[model samples]
Target: MQTVIFDLDGTLADTSGDLIAAANACFQALGHGEVLDPLADALTAFHGGRAMLTLGFERLGVDTSDVVDREFPNLLVHYEQGIDRHTVLYPGAIDAVERLRANGYAVGICTNKPEGLAELLLMRLGIRDLFGSLIGADTLPTRKPDVAPYAASVERAGGVVGKSLIIGDTVTDLNTARAAGVPCILVGFGPEGSGVARLNPDALLDHYDGLDQIVARLIGHPVLV
Candidate 1:
């Protein structure tokens, strides 16, 4: 079976706002008062909590990473409380997934987010049951860009690595597909806008309405319509 693996943040959904808010909460605890703007720093937020902490710390002229480690857990705590506060699935994301599943494509998520957080966010978004499988950052010994998690996600979703591809919004996702020797379809509608094309993915999806045809074209499935 053919499989379509998705990256959670900035791919199927815009999770940056809540992510940045969590990091800002950590900064606020230290009297920094929301050092990370949910709007301006959205791209950085998708890089993960550590990146946000490092960016905020740099703003405070603090060169040490010890504090970043210290505040990491706190950031997670804050994030869990409001995971879906400002998060929303991209337009046509669910519709695309449904159409693909209806057409016999295996669909799953391989996110760099922790397993628990990914599950929680999906459930909060009321889309958990839609995915056939989920491979998170800690699902295996290693994560994305490492082929292991990607392959695992495909297999668990009842597909083979040879007939799989990834839809994502980051370099990490591109690297993951490259390592897996699969085509990468990046979302041009993500936080980086059309700038993601610089990575030169196999295809750039500007909207989900055309995804059925794009996936079929790239993965060798018969065009759905």
Candidate 2:
């Protein structure tokens, strides 16, 4: 089956607000009182908890490595508790996925988030059933930009690696697709906004509504609708 693998954080949803809040909770416990800004630090949040913590520590002139290692677990606890507080699915994301599935495609997620957290977020969002498989940061020995997890995700989704494409929002995803010899579509509406275009993916997705057309064109399948 042909497959469309999506990146969870910025590709399918805007998880930055909640991610930043969790990182802020870590700083708040240390009396730092919210060192990262939601709007300004959103990109860092999508990068991962460690990146956010490192950025906050840098802003406070502290040794980032030690604090990050110590507070990383706390950040994950906070994030798991309130993961959906400010997270929202990108508009039409579900509809787009449904369209693809109805048109004979298998859909799945491959994220840099830990597997447990990714499952929790998808379950809480009530969209866990949409994906045939989910490969996360720790789901395998390595993560994105490496071909292992990507290939695993595709195979688990019942897709041939040679017939798959990735939908993502970062250079990590782009590099992963390139390494796997597959096409990638980067979202223009992610935390990096239209600047994601600079990565020059096989296609740019400004909205989920255009996904069918883009996927069809790149994968050489006819759009069902």
Candidate 3:
């Protein structure tokens, strides 16, 4: 079967708010007081905890590497505790995934997030059972932009790599799909907005409502309107 692999953060959901909150928590612990802004630093949040910490340290005129390494664990702890507080699935995301499944496509997640954290977030959102497989940063020896994890995610979801496609929000996901020799569909609603088109994916998804058609077209599957 064909697969539609999704990148968790910034793709299926807007996780930047909670991510920034977690990073800010670390700064607060050190008397820095919320160095990261939820609105201004959203893109950095999607880049991951380390990136957020580094940005915070830079803004505070401190050594970023040492602080990032030292407080990374604390950031994760705070993140896991309130992962879904401000996180929410993009509009029509769940419905689109369900439609894809009903149309005979295997849907799964291949994220750079830690496996346990991804599972926890999905479970909290009440959508863990929706995916056939979920491959996280540590699930395999390597992560995205490396074809290994991407292929693993597809196979684990009972899909053929040749017929699979990836739907994501960043260049990382685009590169991963390219490395795996599969089509990629980048979400236009992400932090980068329609500017993601510059990356030249197989397609740009403007909204989840059009995902089924986009997936079918890219993967060579037919869907009856």
Q: What's the lDDT for residue 211 in model 2?
A: 95
lDDT of every model, 2 decimals: 0.93, 0.93, 0.94
- All candidates' TM-scores? 0.97, 0.97, 0.97
lDDT agreement of model 2 with the native: 0.93
Candidate 3, residues 67-183, lDDT tens digits: the string is 789999999999998899999899999999999988888999999999999999999999999999999999989999999999999999999899999999999999999999999
Q: What tens-digit string does per-residue lDDT give for candidate 2 at 136-166?
A: 9999999999999999999999888888999
Q: Candidate 1: worst 10 consecutive residues by lDDT?
A: 216-225
State, as a TM-score between 0 and 1, how close model 2 is to the true structure.
0.97
| True lDDT of residue 173, candidate 2 | 97
Q: Could you list the CA RMSD of all candidates, in the order they appear? A: 1.8, 1.8, 1.8
Clash pairs, candidate 3, are none
Arranged by lDDT, best first: 3, 2, 1
